[model samples]
Target: MTDLAVTLLLFFALVSTAIAIALLRSLFAVVMLSGVFSLLAALLFIAMDAVDVAFTEAAVGAGISSVLMLGTIALTARHEMKPKRWSATPLIIVGIIGAFLIYGTLDMPAFGDPNAPVQTYLNPDFIARTPKEIDVPNIVTAVLASYRGFDTMGEVAVVFVAGLGVTMLIGGSGGFLRRRYRETVLSRKDGQA
Candidate 1:
């Protein structure tokens, strides 16, 4: 009962933060609220006993992501431009996608069901094999490092690609590289003259 209450409170806080983020026009305030949302999400994860995921959310979502967004805002505008006209197209599309998502979840097993496929099949095998196959003292470490290595690698790759894309977008076109190239060309012309 206590756990359920805590989870509900966290969910409410998350929803409120998300709504605040959507309504705010100030980029800085939006970015800060996004960090608050991440922190709340991390707390929710903690409530679910997913400490590792909570840590990652706090570090990447709140810490690094907030910094990157702030830097982007510093380079660009502090306030969002007012929309010329309201459009219902995006809202309708979002509603359709959300309906599909809710429909998809309808077939999923109840949370923490002891008879769930993973609980019945994989958990026992992992418990029995961890000491024999991996020899890792910690089951969580063994599972993450060995059993899910490919998935973990893919996650890392995704983060790396996202960071690369952000860097390229920030320094691309009429920005840092352009200024450096211009300076280099001017210096070479001056030396030659």
Candidate 2:
């Protein structure tokens, strides 16, 4: 199939997964579906020739996140409590934010647009200098680790902070996660009535 066809199919799959995740009450199923969604996203990234991003999504998004969520389920509740009522406030807020984001993207160049700034300058500069200056065989690594080193470092810092926060929340002494686990067990027992 053509690239556009594959992209559309993946987009459909993504939407379907999102809907399933939203509607499911089982946390286990939601976690599994999220992994599937991540894997699909990785495939889409691969199609876009962003192998590094695809690898990261597959490893972190699908692999580590799914495992961590499963561990959380093992420690807490497996099923969600049914809400008494639904609120449209969050939906409306998200819609407004999404609309603004889409509006902001209106002025951006199209994908693979030759006249785009990156295509005109940064890419060429990287292509010319990387061979001699970086001496890296893989251009993607050379570009990401060298040319965009600071940006990559920022991303690493964010991930490190997030992981540290999660560890402290769940692993440290006097952590609230223990209280949550106890409450979850008690709630499940109560629900058995």
**Model 1 bad stretches (over 4 Å):** 132-137, 156-177, 180-193
**What C-alpha lDDT does candidate 1 achieve relative to the native structure?**
0.92
Instruction: Report the number of the highest-lDDT candidate.
Output: 2
Q: How much does candidate 1 score in TM-score?
A: 0.81
Error of 2 at 136 (Å): 2.0
What is the per-residue lDDT of model 2 for residues 1-193, given as tens digits with 9 covering 90 to 100? 5999999999999999999999999999999999999999999999988898999999999999999899989999999999999999989999999999999999999977999987897788888898999998778999788888999999999999997987786667647778888899999999997
Q: Show the lowest summed lDDT stretch of 10 residues, model 1.
A: 166-175
Question: Candidates' lDDT values, in order?
Answer: 0.92, 0.93
**Model 1 agreement with the true structure over 95-129: per-residue lDDT tens digits:** 99999999999999998898988789889999999
- For model 2, where is the 10-residue window of minimal lDDT? 169-178
